[model samples]
Target: NRADGFASDSVTVLDPAAGTLTFLSEAAKLAVEEFVSRYGEGGKENFIKEHILKNFYAFELMMAPYTVGHLKMSFLLEELGYRLQDDDRFKLYLTNTLEMEELAQTELPGMASLSEESHLAGKVKKEQPVLVILGNPPYSGVSANRGKWIDDLLKKGYTRSDGYKDDGYYQIDRKPLGERNPKWLQDDYVKFVRFAQWKIDQAGEGVLGFITNHGYLDNPTFRGMRQSLLNSFNEIYILDLHGNSLKKEKCPDGSKDENVFDIQQGVAIALFIKKKGEKKDCKVYHSEIWGLREEKKYDWLLKNDIKTTDWRKLSPKSEFYLLVHRDESFLRSYEKYLKITEAFPLNSVGIVTSRDSFVIDSDKEALKRRIRMFRDEKMPDELVKQTFNLKDKSNWKLKVVREKVRKDEHWEDSITKILYRPFDIQWVFYHDNLIERPRKEVMRHMMEENLGLVSVRQVAEGIFNHAFVTDNIIESRVTLSNKGIAFLFPLYLYSDTDKKETGNPNKKRSLGSTMMLFEPKAEYTIKKPNLSPQLVERLTCQYKKTPSPEEIFYYIYAVLYSNIYRTKYAEFLKIDFPKIPFTKDYKLFSKVAEYGKRLVDLHLLKSVELDSPVAKFQGDGDERVEKLRYDGGEKCVYVNRSRYFEGITKEVWEYQIGGYQVCSKWLKDRKGRRLFLDDIKHYCKIVTSLQKTMEIQKVIDNIYPEAEKETIEFENK
Candidate 1:
């Protein structure tokens, strides 16, 4: 009948027209029946049924080949349809399996989930027809697994993976294992690029295109990832976004550009095309601007066409704030400006810490380099102190650090590992007024706990609590934290202008007859009033045998600023400045002035008195200070203060004694190191007040005049 199958199921077939007997012929059937009687004892009907079912079962067992073949055929058809019969056209595979989360659980624990082959099976072909494949892969960073899981996942095929077996592999570990080095894995994007390249090779065609995270371009964590990509793609296009730049519908409010401290991390997108084998040299075009609508032509941008200005160069805007160090023995406000704007430029000012020994903020690359150099530059003495020494870097310090990292510890074990190495050619800002701070630091309350002046607290919270207590917070006051104090120490130290007498090696130490030497304790009070009282007391005890009246004054000030005394002063001794009088009644005036000088000696006060008018009181570091008495006569007072400690008015002291002037003079003079404690405290107070005042003005208009008034008075001019 048909050339396709048996002619009939029930009858013995005979092709009489061709004169040949078929296997189903009557004679052949008789022989088959006899053979069955002799060997196949089972009935023919049962045997036939069993044989047919067995064959069907075998067919089902080999169904994988058919399914796989169908996929291959579909790919071929698609490639042919797309006219990809050539040998060098690019091919793409876009997989959509369980997404990044599921993959982290199944195959790549402790790592970001990535695109898989299931989704891409239909997208890719055995043959290539396109130049490149590229698109934004769906983001899978929002999984519930904390970074702990990612860390473990990174070690899945490495030694560390065994430590975290409970987490297990992702759900889509469908691929066969190969002799690949698991330690080489850096991140999801890296895996994506590598996998895509492998698929391109499978296609026996052109190159690959991948659009993924741009972090590899610069981030330290992605260094290895970057090297891998660099080896693959000759051309790279980077589109950097301000921190937290992703625009997602699920976001409550789209994030804006901000300091790294304000947000977790910065985000960017990248386009990569491999140029491993090519006839023409690869061309690269980079541009940040997208979706441009022009007069006639679509302004599609290439990197070469993009101007340098189009790329963002980060700088602190006028809105940025700077912490200054001025009068503290080692601090000043302008010095702070210099520190941020010049010394430690915004780009270079990585971070500061309250506890210097415990926490260090270093450049990531610098840290790595330092670690390498430190290892290489070791002398025998250095090696003796270490518990263990590495023979080579193959034993990744990451493992060592991880092992040394105490469970839930606050600080890292390696002390030298955390140091920050600044970039060569420290960042210098050519533009003046690069940043304008809207806020200024000021004193919160003066005359609190009978102390004439007190420092302010910052408006924002700090990492570590300030070591000292502060007075009440009014509308405007200076705010300094432990963090600020540590940051401004160098700047403040550079700005001390008061001259100091040093002992000659062969001569006995003696106080110079240079009128009055502001006690080191007083300078300290003026500089860092935030230091703890215990520390101040110890310094005072060491500096002077019987603390001078000024030292006594500073001691009292220190006691008041101590955490134990702040609440007491706030409740019992807090005084409104309005109550203090500036009268010349000798009994009151002498007592007040004596107490004031005592506080200065004790490092409790940051006060400097000036003549009411300028030229009349001018002298060689000396002046006769007069006060109005009840008798209507001028009561003469001796003024033997540092000539640099000038007062603008009876109530307003010049607290912002320029730091650069002081440092330059000190450097040029090259006299023995003289430390002033009061300058440090004064610097802190002035800068804090300046910052607070500026901040208040930013929030409320017309508040600066009043704020400035309080700040000036608190400066104790």
Candidate 2:
């Protein structure tokens, strides 16, 4: 009843209502009962005369809810033997709390009629800052039609004329400082949190309580929001509900996979309070609850143990302060010793095609079929008959992309093409030169779609696959976060920016989870480094006097892939780039790098190299292994780990039906069947690679060591 220390003296209880009075009624009922319990209702007989008229208040944007809430509050008072009259100073009114203008109508998204509202039917002017500010806020992401009042609070500290500003308002986590300007703060719930703080800030002392998207607790993007909370509130309480399917983040406890809310994302209850004249550093308490339903969590909150700790123990000034930890000493050691930004100074989010169906695909043949379908239904010859040319390469984006075919000329001129994905109905672009194969063979075997996208292809054992192809390639991969391609892909690639000539690579891209290597910079629409030769050599070169790029790359890579790094830094791996730990000892670092090189060689070893030791091994699969793939013909690789080629972990076949999970597209027929020669080869590579990677952790442990995690072993009493 007294959450945030509500008392008889707290004459104002306000909810910037989301069209509900249910909470207000509960609060009133609690306030009346508590008053009776504590003071035995010394003189007051009616609840409204004693409590409701002066203390209860709410503001809503919609008229329907406002009216219903007003009536509900009146009836609730009546039920308690106190009837609310017309002049009883009914505090519930139609208003947009975010945009608390002098007027309430003509504001609120699509609620133009709520303009005629003031303090309790213009009864009480709330000049004093409220003692308690509380409610659940909407968690929708920022939109084109989002509230301007909220947007200003997100982009800047103050909204319109409400000039409450905090120094921590604009903080974005950085690699080279401001490298990652995260927009996740634009989420709706963040704005509400800020708004609550603003209300408290204006009052100079008050409590702000909210049940919200738990991302604010640990998402690196919301660090600024957390910072504001620290600056404003001296005492904070965080109750985490760990079930986020949007992130597919499971509860730390063994609860059901589903979250408390209907939505897929996780939720949390946070209470922030700062009393008048309190300016000392904030003290924070953290706890967690988990279950399939909201009621299960509620039951635990009231009846069970609350595992909590001092917030300072999490190291608030650290890069990811929201992580739960007993101590951050080892992490501090890694921070002082190693840094990833020294090598890779830039990164970016992968391309977002707004239209996925026409642009993205697992099967290139299927993509071509889409093109053919469009051609048959809507092609006009006049639009295709005209030959087009442009002087500026920039203008080429507006025209079309052409797939490289055997002949330069087109038999497709009459095939009706206003716009198609750079290919004729019958033609297929060979990702590699087609001098070796039939057009039909290229179409059937080589996976190529949309002119430059090549999904897969297999060839001779001696020949390199995908090592030499060029032409504005975009290896759109998000496997890093999913745990699949994260370890397998190179932190830096030794790509031939210029074909047929190879040495130290002139170009490189860091492909990994949580890292945004240089963003789309050039005409190719791919992220590139500042084009500094030193950066390229550092990540791509295999040999140098000392601290070679290959050595640093592998050293960092090996450290990143280890379970030590994963377990110790689990919180950071979410929504953040790697903050790599580096070493000054060339001898120790080089040895680790050597191991990294072996893994790299194994990972990049083309499936075409059939007889090579790396490509000849085989393994087995069973019911536990739900998905596996291997090319039935010549020299193809097998993936026994993930249901999808891009995903990291293995799971049941049912995982694919989820919108973004594409495991269903992998070769499912071979899942539980006998392992192929190619399949075993990849598994062997993973096992061998992991064995080598573990060495780096040991090497690092020898120097800037990790704290031995306490283990609990149960014995029979």
Candidate 3:
């Protein structure tokens, strides 16, 4: 599958302008075509002996592909009129490349005898495998076994022994691992990379090139790997081909985008070269190929010397997009603000009920999660029949959950429950979990206005509409839905989980959103600390001389809801939690806090009441919908929809929030997995319309001006 340099330009009578197409895969064709077009010279026979057969190599795990690979090379040779020798010494091997080397070196647990060729492949390490290691590795699931050698790789944690020596010019952020270390170093592609790096290290001077997942280039999780490459490789090139659903990025030029392969995630081509010498003062050359047709992408790769371009000449060390942040206030806030972890270190996603049918049903007389289900809130008969084997289908087995004592257990009533769902850039809280039907009048009002939560109806195209289609796809996947019938998973947190769940407190308190900060109590301890507890404290106290969490959250909220933050920090927010910006001025803090509180209220539906004219409900039984109307029904929240749609009052579903399946923000995340309707409880969305959000942003901007562009600009030098 990692075949390279096989592009065919054979022409025919049909479609004369573009020429005829070859049946060969791009990689196979590129391998042959690139050689003929760029480097083929002199007699073909001698070249085959010295270069093609000797230097060219292919490693495959399966015999089928291995045979196909051999045939491909042979076919290409024959096309050049070179007859194949009987026992051609093609480097292709029918063995699993992942473990062959290690298995050959030393016996690991479950170690088995190896064939002569496998042993030889393993022995190549001592002989120096190659000066240039290149291939496309598998990118499916992670390795099930993290054998001893792999564990060592994870713990080794730095540049290879033969690295190009660190010069600090091409470095990435590094801190001692206590916690928060990237856990994905074991991913298949990363391991292949690790293997490639090892080969180069053994050779002392070599090139490691491959087309693989582009995530390692910028994802915070792969920082150490990046740093290792920076320290070890003298020269590097990264050509990011943005197509993965995880990125949710469009073609930069507005062209239709699809993954470069059958896979849903984006891919990149990286070439790392190191010569045995002193460290060179160079950054990795990085370029991007976005939204091009499949043929054009392959053509570009074939035509370009990926290593010779200016990559990081633009934004070498900045976060994705190479944009720098120079806001003094932001810098100050980051420097001084206390992190949220200091206060409420405890945090977790809302509760996940693994078996909903067995733990819940609709009858108020029936117990679900130790509480009786409100009679009107009964699950559909079809849903119950599909999932549970109940006595008359009225009973559920909840004792295992309700009776089991766990660390964060809470009393039924006191438990903090929220329909916590991410809506695009915001975490939309749509309902409270009380397991009871709302008052009829209130339900009617909300349903009519499309503002209040209704009985869960997960059937798509019923209430919420599709958020957005990936490329041209419009189908929905059902297996991953929450209730096996509906798609939603309410956030569950116990009252006892009160001590943690912290935020970063900053001095720029003039802006605010869902963020808030409080001081670390003497009794507070770190929960799920990504950084060491010691570093957490140091980082939490870095900026302010005498740090205080005073009104920190409000300022964060203000910034979060600000147009500037959303528009600028859009990329950062997708992969990581909000790192709020704070300010020291109390006046600015309070003003921003006010806006945050208003947003909080607006989302909580505090402005409207049960009897308010805007509150309304509709339908009966399954087809029911709820709403909250304003501006004479011109604005509303369709509390129950596959996702919000459009119209002044139409609420469109946004798949980008929470990276959830309902949002479809990252299709590559759980590729081929189903999305439970129960997990998508907040199909609910709110908006008077698109312009209203913008106008609201304007109000915020007027209250406190955003940092001007001049304030953040920096010269390339």
lDDT of 1 at 454: 27
Candidate 2, residues 1-717: lDDT per residue as tens digits? Answer: 344223365546766644668767777787777666666765345545746677766767676887788788778877766776655745777655655345544545643343445433333223545666677777776533257766666555642113434544465342221423355666667766776677677777777777888877765556666776776777888777767775555445544656767886688888887777767888777766666665676566667543433233334765545634434555544454323333443222222233334433434566456444333424443342232221224423212333232133432221111111111012222222211221221121112111111111111111111111112222223221322111111133222232224231212222341122442222322222322344434323323343434455666555554455655654444344444554434555566566555544433332222233322333443323453453434333344552222212332222221122232333342355544445444444433332332444466455432222221111110
Q: What order do you get sorting by TM-score, best first? A: 2, 3, 1
Candidate 3 TM-score, true structure as reference? 0.61
On lDDT, the leading prediction is 2
Give the Cα error of residue 81 in candidate 3, in Å: 5.2
Residues 1-717 of candidate 1: C-alpha lDDT, one tens digit per residue: 222112112211111011111111223234335536655645544433332111110000122432443344335434323222343221112222112332222343542223342223233322222233333332234422234434443324222111212211211122222212222234444444444443333332334433344434432233333433333344545554323323211122432333122333334445555443432333334334322124111233222433442443221111111111112231222122111112111111112222221122223344334334333424342362253333323433433433343231322112222111100111111111111111112211111122222222111121211112122111111123211111111111111322223321111112232133234345442232332233334334543332343333333333322232223223111111111111212233233334334333222213232112221222253222232111112211113332222222221121111111211222222123232343323333333332332232233222212211211011210
RMSD of each: 28.3, 12.2, 12.9
Please count the clashing residue pairs in each candidate, in the order shown: 89, 15, 105
Q: Judged by TM-score, which candidate is best?
A: 2
**Candidate 2 TM-score to native:** 0.65
TM-scores vs. true structure, each candidate:
0.25, 0.65, 0.61
- Quote model 1's TM-score: 0.25
Question: Candidate 3, which ten residues in sequence have the lowest lDDT sum?
Answer: 11-20
Off by over 4 Å in 1: 1-131, 142-190, 201-207, 239-243, 246-269, 275-284, 290-717
Q: Which stretches of candidate 2 lie over 4 Å from their true place?
A: 1-7, 45-47, 101-113, 118-128, 143-145, 158-165, 172-181, 247-258, 292-296, 304-315, 323-327, 360-477, 480-546, 607-665, 668-717
